[model samples]
Target: MALKETRRPSIFWLMAWVCFGLLGGSVKFRVAHPERIPERGAFVIAPNHYSEIDPVIVGMMLYRLGRIPRFLTKASLFKIPVVGWFLRRSGQVPVERAGSAAAKGPSPLAAAREIARAERIVVVYPEGTLTRDPDMWPMRGKNGAARIALEQGIPVIPVAHWGTQALMGRYAKKINLLRRHPIDFAIGKPVDLSEFEGKPIDQHLLADATEKIMGAITAELEKLRGDKAPAHRWDPSLHGQSETGRIEP
Candidate 1:
């Protein structure tokens, strides 16, 4: 007989979100504005990739809040001996990092579709890889998240995270909760790309939208952390215009 699967129970997700929100009280978590997204519907929770544990923490937050989020995880991870079993049972999608097949794999897309059909939330790390943002900011990303949003007609909510760097730098592979860092998460309003409707949904548009959303996230993050990001083109002081003015289709 096949081995039994280890799925993430609804109760577990609910409890996880609640526990995290409550736990966040001890730390310093600001929801920013929770009214941005509807409580129910198919939406994308796109957060920057910082710590490997970021996904779990964000997932726990949503789960505790009574929302189920599907994550796009690396395919290689599924090859691991026993851990892969747990991932599959938990309904996580394994993503190949290499070729076209990896980008548009049928199985993962199907899983994404199913999650949307269920009217649940999905978490995605758009950066494709951990940040190379010298400043630990989000790097340019692959637009799989945007494509998913367009195809499914779901809103993409940008989520910015801070304090994780203090918890664990880019080089650190584990969490140090005992350090009691003030982890920050700011969720931007749902981005509506309906204007792109009927047009060919190409990577260019998808990538552009993803960048815009991430940019919004970063701006919010900067405000919360009271830090200054590098003066890139997005920096208004250098351009005399807001980064939002530079978004491309």
Candidate 2:
């Protein structure tokens, strides 16, 4: 028999915000530049994916900042136990990374296109998974965000989040109430991808663009956390430090 899918229901956002509020995770957001995004249209909020709870933290921040977003999550996450139910109830979109060719399910790109033509927002984590880096530095991301941004003429807003990893760990599992750390988010001005609208999304171009976005996000995180910039080649193994140390910024 085919496996059933899990998703987040529309009310998930409401419940998630309440849960976080009760848990004491502070939510702060600032939109320094709104011109980056169009006055009123579909746009992409591309952020670095660092922990499991990142969606909730970032999603709530977006909502509080006056934008309701449709988040793209992993298909496998929708098959979990109770969590799966909550995801579906929250109206989250589940994406199949593998066997995606079988059928065109609700892809992030599709959601982005819809956002471009609709009134809602789409939250896409370019980095498909949590960062393996101990410092939580963003790894190389996929081309999904770039493709949607260029193809649909939508603005790309880069969001940076910090502190959620402490509550959920690098690889999110159960809640870490013991840590009880505070989290913060910073939203950068939207980026215009019209220059590459029609050009092929080559690896070099995509990588460069993704790197630029990640860099901006990391910088914001650093500013918020009062941390120094990480070395361009920040390999913990080379320095004999644990991967967790590099995760802060």
lDDT of 2 by residue, 52-110 (tens): 77877776655544455677777778889977887777656677655654266666677
Model 1 stretches astray by more than 4 angstroms: 1-28, 99-110, 231-249
> Which ranges in model 2 have alpha carbons more than 4 Å from their true place?
1-18, 21-39, 77-90, 100-104, 178-180, 192-194, 231-249
Ten contiguous residues with the weakest lDDT in model 2: 1-10
Give TM-scores for every candidate, taking all chains together and pairing residue i with residue i: 0.75, 0.73
What's the lDDT for residue 206 in model 2? 76
How many backbone clashes are present in model 1? 3
| Residue 15 Cα positional deviation in candidate 1, in Å, after optimal superposition | 9.4
lDDT of 1 by residue, 115-221 (tens): 78887777877765566554666666667677778898888888887776665566565656564667667778777677776789887777777777667667767
